[model samples]
Target: MRTLTLGTPRLTAGLDQHHRVDHTAHRELHGPLPQLGADDLITLAGLGSLRGRGGAGFPFARKVRAVQTSVLRRDSTARVVVNGTEGEPGSVKDRMLLTRAPHLVLDGAELAARALGSPEVVIGVADEGARAADPVLDSLRSAVDERGSGTVFRVVRMPDRFVSGQAGALVQGINGRVPLPPGTPRRTSESGVAGLPTLLSNAETYAQLAVLAIGGADRYAQEGCASQPGTVLLSVSGDTVVETAAGTRLSRLLSACGLSSARAVLVGGYHGAWLSGEEMSRARLSRDGMSEVGGTLGAGIVLPVTGDTCPLGETARVLRYLARESSGQCGPCVRGMPALADSFVRLLSGEGSPEDVLVAAGIGEGKGACAHPDGSAVFARSALRVFSEDLSTHSLTGGCSRPVKGELPLPDGYDTPAHPRLLVDWSRCDGHGLCAELLPGLVQLDRNGFPEEPDIPVPGPLEGDAELSVRMCPALALRIRAPEPGSAR
Candidate 1:
């Protein structure tokens, strides 16, 4: 949990001041966080126009209202779930909050529980490989005994997949299921986590709530812009974490990070848009400000692209990652993403048809159960728009005339997606056609009575029958090879 402060630190107030993780340090540095009733909290959030720190940027007050209303209508105790799964490859601010100021986040979570009458609070951190790496988990364990609030605290490590951070996915994961978004649209605020009305939000949202609670609405609004008055934590590459006021100009941030010479910037994380150097100079760091320049403050990641590398090639690598991280739930996300990546690959290799990339992007928009496909579309479309010259060079001569330096920050050690395929060990086969008989839709028999493999990965619906077929195979020749590490099985 490295830290950097460009302006005043609101969420990270005590980190640089006290620099301690234990209870005494937290209390002595920032004092106790104020407890507010549900109505007061809602009012404070509405006055500040607080938005979720997660990519969605939905209104925090509205979410609180919905959860409160649902719990009232159902006459049940609501559960508060804190989502600390920072799955965005380029963002680490959430990890910073979790490690440096665990109590601040817990303060926010406890306050929410008191407001909603929720006795239980669950904090979902990712597995050890990703954001839930040792530093954060250790901080959380140490903070547990220091909690003075009466609310029960439970910490669960989520799966380290990209979509596992989605509200629905986190809810599903907490309930002992695979952390994937559900097929239908069911709001977590209404029905979540074992059929209880749940108040769920990302890690940074809770941290902001803590700041508002401790400092009051007037003090909280003193720093940021008029539209959204608050501070935001930004992950500017893995090297530095910047905390600045909302509505700060992108150019100012670039200058502060020694990136004034950058030609273009990848605003937000991978799912975010790209801004040209000219557009970036006028862009603001706030939500409305980013939208004015055709971008959003998604995950608050601002990565500058210098002129030294091939922009098209860099975008192509991120597209490949986006394609691999798909949940395989919808047609557009499963097929369209790979097609988009392939088009970029061909363009980088000098054989691309320009229309294929845009066409694939269009096909993927709004076609997934989750926002994964739509985000991929946004990234692809923005790359095409912002890197037109690079695209032109690649399309014409199959090369951008510049070396690929891998400037864009991609997830470390992200394995390629391998679609689940039927594999046969021929030595163990006895020419049995049982596998073909059990799942005739996927398997076909060869002339020698051996099962002929299907070309595509097995669909999720057929997994039951496929597993049954594997078990029923008399000669043990048929089996399904699991998909690659980052792929959806």
Candidate 2:
């Protein structure tokens, strides 16, 4: 396979040489990883101004210092975790780093472990089809056996869901629990995995760390822009992988990718904003640069939306996937996501009101345990604003005069509609009458103050109120159950 690339190569320097880098090849391409004290790591990271490759864009130096300080305060060893779980459907830089350069990532993990005085390192991979991550798992095992590194490396498979890759959820999974974000958000660096202070970062961040350690700060800074130094791996259109300097212009990248013209572009993944062709042409590929234009280089994804595809229809499909992927732990996410998705679908079909879409999108923000709700909300809001003319056409006349070519990529199994049924646990019910009061339309009080749900599945119209009632239930007895896959809807 040919690797399409631009700018300086550090982490993916020698991927063209081999499928998987063995210990020997790893040592050859990048020499021995330098051992660093905690202070040294912070210094190098600060000098390079390295940001987390994950969606958060947190400073790497601050994160390292946080873990070190936390471990010292607790008087315990810190556990280092490499988050290789590329859960974002539109991103694949993490998987590529793991698959082609697992050893480089391990080298960074080992460095972090040494700096934190830890004995173990955990590499978490997304458990999707398993076929995509199999090579990385095999390479990890091979590296462990061949290198005989003193540090204990464990490979854990994370849940394939979007929110499962969150640092807290990944830690929970590593601790042998279902990979879901805790209701009360906690910093994994403060307390994680067997209650030890943990240092966790994205896979590409670790690979970059390895590069910084081996190549030294001065050499690393030679590449990329002043604000952000070093190279970034981008998964363009889910097919072509490009390694470019941080400040490369989006227009230049697109030109290199052979797209002469485009209607619009999505900087970042699904959570990121949409930019017009002119705006994107002027925007830079770096995080800071993209931010200037109300966009983000989140998860290293840059997908162009060609004029032929209907942006509204593509957006509706994505919203549908996001709605289906909701963790169901949060009421707003469970309810608001479906409402937003269904509303978008209706709006696309020229049947729904734009006000309902706006309301659902507004309600979804900041109401969940994680960023899923907020991200989806941002995506929807951006879509509505970016495609205003299209919305006008659909709303006024009920037609855009264009067919949806499905330009945006939606993964398999997420396209199916969610047929949800509400289930109430009689044992936990105390009959405070709040659920019935909140959603009188969906829940009716029986003789014994028990709630009686309708015989049919909860209709989409009542979903918002139903979820609110579920959330407000004093006994936590209410829950929504989705139909099993391939089961009768």
Candidate 3:
């Protein structure tokens, strides 16, 4: 494939030191990954502690086995994709590997590609900084060029949108479709990238693949806890102030980036939880580890929150932004999130109700199309849990009164959520009759005016989004929102 290299985060971000694979040597070692016998790969992965890098930290063996079995039963060419779209706001590990150690990342992708029948290995990238995409591209090119053996493929530079980093959305974008997440269930390993049985994983996961290739399972298992082995990259931006041992419980880790002097840490992404005080301090960065703390190791992203701002207000702003980021494919996410956002806003403004809190927590606690709903719900729940003190404070007095510091990241929340209740943007809209006519239960029309929607809950399907309402709207003002969370699978 490409001239491989291994080991990254040259800066040694966290407290732990990662023993990464040497991509160059890793390339030489790829002499056919010894066709792992049944459960052998999973055992090896488990031994190596091959936790998924996509933040969720699902065991590689779990996904590997799932994809392996799925492909074995189906008679189709299995495919693979290295999702390099690192879109979480506070996290920067995947692109970090790409920019500095492209070969390592590519070598990882190649190693997995080889083990999995050398299926189409498409490395996709769309980093936060324009500068980020180049390094990975250069590295992938070099690795492919060096192999001359022909197996590696091209690196696709994706458009840098928030959800474009999602595995399904990324696959859809690569296959020449809108870069939005899908609603109905579609597994990447089952049907991904051109309707092929594909094995799509995050960029860091690929790099880890290369590492596992060269290190073998034993070398991979050397570090980290037993439940799940390996060192995980964590962005400590969640904490803004340095926490002392007494005030913080920082994981004595291989790499705790940005944790030098922190307050709280956003354990997950935007949809992640905000753990403050000892909660942030004591937390570790691993699937098994984060799980122990009621937080997840999703996408390997963590933001440490310091005293620079009020955690409550910061979370509120982030909630609003996440609401907008909803693909608008499900109702729970499209509308429910906005409502929750408003609740958070009201709380921040000292104009909230206890009922608001209870309702926000209950609405989609169970029903929704995707994990976006769950993710948002988790964020809301965790926010309430941690910031409850703030809410109580606000209730006692007028409000936190702290300015809604935009410090909480709403990476794309600003541009999307201005739909203005029912106002339509005609030029951008073509009445497919979807908004008004599609789901008459959810929407209706004014006596002598435009279309209108009732307060009915939206159905999960896009048609429920009311294609007729969209078709009928002279201006495409109505957007269908899917209320679901995204899984690494």
Clash counts for all predictions? 1, 0, 82
- Candidate 3's C-alpha runs over 4 A off are 1-40, 127-133, 238-261, 410-419, 423-435, 438-489
Alpha-carbon RMSD to native, per candidate? 5.3, 5.4, 7.7
Instruction: Put the candidates in lDDT order, highest first.
Output: 2, 1, 3
Off by over 4 Å in 1: 130-133, 415-489
Candidate topping TM-score: 2
Error of 2 at 207 (Å): 0.5
Q: Please state the error at residue 2 of candidate 1 in Å.
A: 3.7
lDDT (10s digit) by residue, model 3, range 1-489: 111111332122221322332345444434334444436656777777676777566677777777777777786566678888776666566656665445556666655565666456887788436363465566556656655674657577676666677777888888888777877758887788778767777876766666566568665555545665445544435222121111122454313343456566676687677676666556765555566678876765556565666777777656656665666665566567667776776775568965795587566555654566677778777877777777888877866545545555545435233223344554464434556545443354466444443333332233434545545555556554433332100
lDDT of 2 by residue, 274-364 (tens): 8886688789988889989888888888778888878888888788777767665666775678778878888876798778888988766
TM, every model: 0.86, 0.87, 0.76
* Winner of 1 and 2 under TM-score: 2
Kindly list the per-residue Cα lDDT of model 1 for residues 374-471, writing each as its tens digit: 88788878988899888878777868667767777776643344235567778788877887666654565789987664333454445677688778
What's model 3's overall lDDT?
0.59
Candidate 2 accuracy as TM-score:
0.87
In TM-score terms, candidate 1 sits at 0.86
lDDT of 2: 0.80
lDDT of 1 at 344: 72
Off by more than 4 A, model 2: 129-133, 418-489
